[model samples]
Target: MDDQPSLARRGPRHSTNLVGRSSEWLESCAFNDAPAPLHIWGVQEMNQGLFGMLDQAADLAEAGEAFHAYMMAMFGIDDEQRDVPSAGRQRFRSSFLRLIQGWSFDSNGPAGAVLKGWVESRFGVCPSFHKEIIDAVPGPAWEVYTEEKMSSQFHNNAIWVQLDLLFEFCQWAIRRFAFPGQSHLTLYRGINDVERHLIVERTDRREAVIRLNNLVSFSSDREVADCFGDRILTARVPLCKILFFPGLLPSHLLRGEREYLAVGGEFRVSVDYV
Candidate 1:
């Protein structure tokens, strides 16, 4: 916890870190990724001496910077280290390998990357909807699912983020049609970090993940059902995993949002969603 700038780098056994196989993995799989909020800073810092891209939201070099930053950050590197130049063939390949390894990009990376890729190709924007989401959506209407503010191992002490699938879709629809009305993508709260991540409910095999902070919260199970027309928590088990926590969870948790915050930690009752 004392080390902010310095990060723990695990030189997993050579078998655990397969550079060549990893490259093959990334090369074969479909890539869909967005810049996590923390990654944005990393990319900007790294791309400083590189591209003079002016646009914050649209430029390709900026997008590449953001992507590379995310790749570096996944390797447990500090944000500043994210931009180390990879001009050489070996260095570029190694750096890229680190990302493949972090993603466990064996056959497929995590769902977040796949989904973000979809958002990118379809909407032409990254999913780090920091301001864009709040701007387009009205606060009082629908549900507002905001991320929790957290400092932990997996998430690397970064603030949390959520994706309201339905709301995001609504936002997409509005933008695609150039509709001048508003966004159904409001904010939602409830279910602390653990519960938010406990269920691996699938939208599909490709988009099976729904972020805890990004979904609407009902005071009870009935509420969860009535609001989203689906069940996130059982009516009787209103607070299930949300209230209880663990230390070092399943390896699957190592991927996507679950990995963002180290999964294994003692329980600390959560009171707020950022």
Candidate 2:
């Protein structure tokens, strides 16, 4: 904690631009808050068994293939290759997988901003960082992030709703099969330095609450996580927080480090200085 930036040094600037939503909504969505993970679309959607087809799959690989096919059908992506090229079909071709791939390449880029904006709209969790610190106040940083989001969504056919459904599918799959009885998974994130992280609240010498970006990557495998950085951030991440995981899709998709994409908020994490 001594090596970390003091809250006073990185406190909110208190802007009134109305660029982001309140953090209170984020707090309420935490796992400890008796969160309704599927509150967005509701259990009724899940009950319709859109993903019940997964039950017949023998393993993760097969399930992934089936899920992918389902997603393609859901968005009418196959229609893109058909006779007439309508505006809707072209837009439907842009997918959540493409969004994540774009983000993996550059988090500060346009795709990253769209992904972050999706989280902010759905979870009410403001992004803490873009290319620069997205301070609490409405300022240049917010404008930069907002501009990227707007531009990306404008040019890319606006797949925001698709991303929402993707998240819903992921959450449903996680609860139904990935970790059926588990409320949280112990996830790890590798980091170059502790100081680079936003430590919002210090609970003690060993623990602190850090405000994560609206969408951040973590790993279920400690060894895979350590390969990326000198330090490790360990947290008990809620199943609801995860947007996607390596096995959630085909091996060809979301490749690298066995990553898990999780929604960001203030999380109490323990840092390993190794």
Candidate 3:
């Protein structure tokens, strides 16, 4: 693997007026309690810079009107005033619900299928269909698809969900470990600085590979080498693979309990004190 940062770049930048308009829409809809169709649509537009065109409008109200018209066209709702139901509107609402409900942030989860299908259809470019091109080119088609999909608004939301879960795990770890008042902890996005540390790489939505550095402070060099069945002094510790459900975990091993902090009812870690 290349070992590059995994998370995608932040959403596109927008003018202050456009941003204010989005905020105003959100407040008007009172979408504070849960995810709603309007909220999701607005967020997707904002991320893709679709709202930037509103800057050409005379004022915020004009921009809002323009946006509403654009939305109506995009959703295939022809009438501006008619409240009557239509097939196009029903399709739009159903599709939006599926998009929201089937969004599993983890690539290995069930929602991945829905996300993949949506991306392929929306872009009209299927990675699996490009086998010939992929074989003839320098880069992998799957890789390209992965990159593009991860950068989409749907994937961005998934990343946000993972980050939220991670934040909760960190809080649990801090409370469980009972660290000293002055102890410092840091969270790295895709890499860590400590030479002697444990790395938990997310292999899928429910699986991760934990590699312990040979020089990790929690274990002696000899012990680390023994774990790998290697006589070399610098041999890397063998990876310990783990599988987990989203909100549940298997019981911790007796050995693990002595060495690490348990978090989120699933993840466990041992950090080197800086």
Model 3: CA > 4 A from native: 1-163, 182-226, 229-250, 253-274
Q: Measured by TM-score, how close is model 1 to the native structure?
A: 0.18
- Deviation of model 1 at 192, angstroms: 21
lDDT of 2 by residue, 1-274 (tens): 0112222234332232122333454432244234445445443354355557767777766776776777677665553332223354344356677667666667678878888777777666667777877654668988998888877453454476667666766876786668887878888887776766767778778688776666788888888778768788888887777888877876444556677888766677888865
Of 1 and 2, the candidate ahead on lDDT is 2
What is the model-wide C-alpha lDDT for candidate 2? 0.65
Q: For residues 1-274, what per-residue lDDT tens digits would candidate 3 score against the true structure?
A: 0011111211111132212233222221122212122112234433344345544655434543554455445544344222222345442222222332233123332334334434233212222211112221235644554554454444433433222222232232233322323222221112232222222345443233333210121222333323322121221211111011122111121122122211100122322221
TM-score for all predictions? 0.18, 0.77, 0.21
Error of 2 at 189 (Å): 0.9
Q: What local distance difference test score does each model get?
A: 0.24, 0.65, 0.28
Q: Show the lowest summed lDDT stretch of 10 residues, model 2.
A: 1-10
User: Lowest summed lDDT over 10 consecutive residues: which window, candidate 3?
Assistant: 236-245
Worst 10 residues of 1 by lDDT: 1-10
Q: Which predicted model would earn the best lDDT?
A: 2
Question: Candidate 1 — which residues are off by over 4 angstroms?
Answer: 1-46, 54-93, 101-274
1 against 3, candidate with superior lDDT: 3
